[model samples]
Target: MHRATFMELCDLLSPALKRKDTKMRGALTVEKQVAIALWKLAMPDSYRSVGNQFGVCKSTVGAAVLQVANAIIDQLLSRVVTFGNVQTIVDGFTALAFPNCDGMIHGTHIPILAPEHRGDQYVNHKGYFSMVLQALVDLKGHFTDISVGWPGKMHDTHIFRNSGLFEQLQEGTYFPDQKITVGDVEIPTVILRDPAYPLMPWLMKPYACTLDSSKEQFSYRLSKCRMVVECAFGRLKARWRNLLS
Candidate 1:
């Protein structure tokens, strides 16, 4: 994070993370708490290691991480991870040659320590314990929606079906009706995804595995448009090394 961004985050989180100081011990400043938490997240350091660097107890470091994280999510999540105007989203994807596309949806596995019970459920096809992070990314590679905490063993289709996004779509509360003409048919605005997802009025996926030339071309175009989400995930894992492992 840049210095300006760090200070901005500190400003946003301080109000919630700040605590009253007592005679027992002066409370750590919000800056210090956020710094410790960011360091812990940016690096693979344990609570003890982070505390040693900050001249604080491991327990204090752990608490600071949890508190600061919750504070950030509570205060900043909606602003940072918003789905803006539907037309704007459609335009963004259209500019990239994907007409009527509002977003690209995908899932990535985030490795994590196995939970105490039912650890086997977290073991993925890659032979590692992980959690699934399903997300919808706009053409600019920003997350418009995200769902986490699903076991890695679960299929992407299963996770998507159980997501709040799916519920909203089912309830007809999400994107307003918008149509685009393709040949003689008018198609509703939709999100792009891989074959792992089911086709719906608002969701578009490529054809199943096939050797037909036209199907191959369609899959190629869809994959090209969907590459934005993959790049976004790659950058996320690269910037946050802790998430990479």
Candidate 2:
């Protein structure tokens, strides 16, 4: 269960969440409850089922989910999710993928129930398709940014633009340079659906890799850096499958 890792996480949270008030110090630790809740969410058992297993009320379980999810995402990702010395923009997907290569993006569906959803927005796409949207993630698969919920029927590019990802890019909040495509796409780069869309300069094509003479010679070149994202996605999906019921 990674006791050391869990304690380290709790220790990091302590400064902000732990209080001096002796009176506030209770019989149990909030961090423990939060960790349990996180496990439940990642695996999403029934609320009543979790309540029984955790020996706590459903309300407490829900609170724990929120508290722990936010804490881990903020703290762990802030420290653990950063890129190491790699050219931040050029090597980073978000820094590379916007307004370029038709802003190539990938979508994945998380398994969740309809009853757990807030509305169609969570599962909302025309035809009530699975919750899916274009996403830009680093080679490490940390979500650098994502487009909001769009109907599955919607074109991936349309979803990219509508999700305000494009607007944010225009404002330089995402990609500073507007000419790089962070990913490979199913279509040709020269084609353009919108007249306003500008063709990008750097187009990446990892999937359609060439068996060129040089590639085989440079087998150990450690090139095709984008494979990191694919590897990351494989691990994430594997974990998700293990956890989700």
Off by over 4 Å in 2: 16-28, 83-104, 116-129, 139-143, 146-155, 162-165, 176-231
Off by over 4 Å in 1: 209-214, 242-245
Best by TM-score: 1
Q: What TM-score does model 2 achieve against the real structure?
A: 0.59
Per-residue alpha-carbon lDDT of candidate 2 for residues 1-245, written as tens digits (9 for 90 to 100): 47886777788765544434367645337565657666686764876788888787778778777676676666666575442332443334334332222223455554445644445545544345455645555544565555544544455555655666567554555443434333564332211122222433223333225568755433322223444445555677798777654
What is the C-alpha local distance difference test score of candidate 1? 0.89
TM-scores of all predicted structures: 0.88, 0.59
**lDDT (Cα, 0-100) at 94 in candidate 1:** 75
lDDT tens digits, residue span 1-245, model 1: 78998899899987899899999999999899999998887777888999999999999999999999899889999988998788888887777777888899999999888789999999999999999999999888999999999998999999999999999977777778778889999987788998878989888888886569987877777889899999999988887674435
TM-score of 1: 0.88
lDDT on C-alpha atoms for all candidate structures: 0.89, 0.51
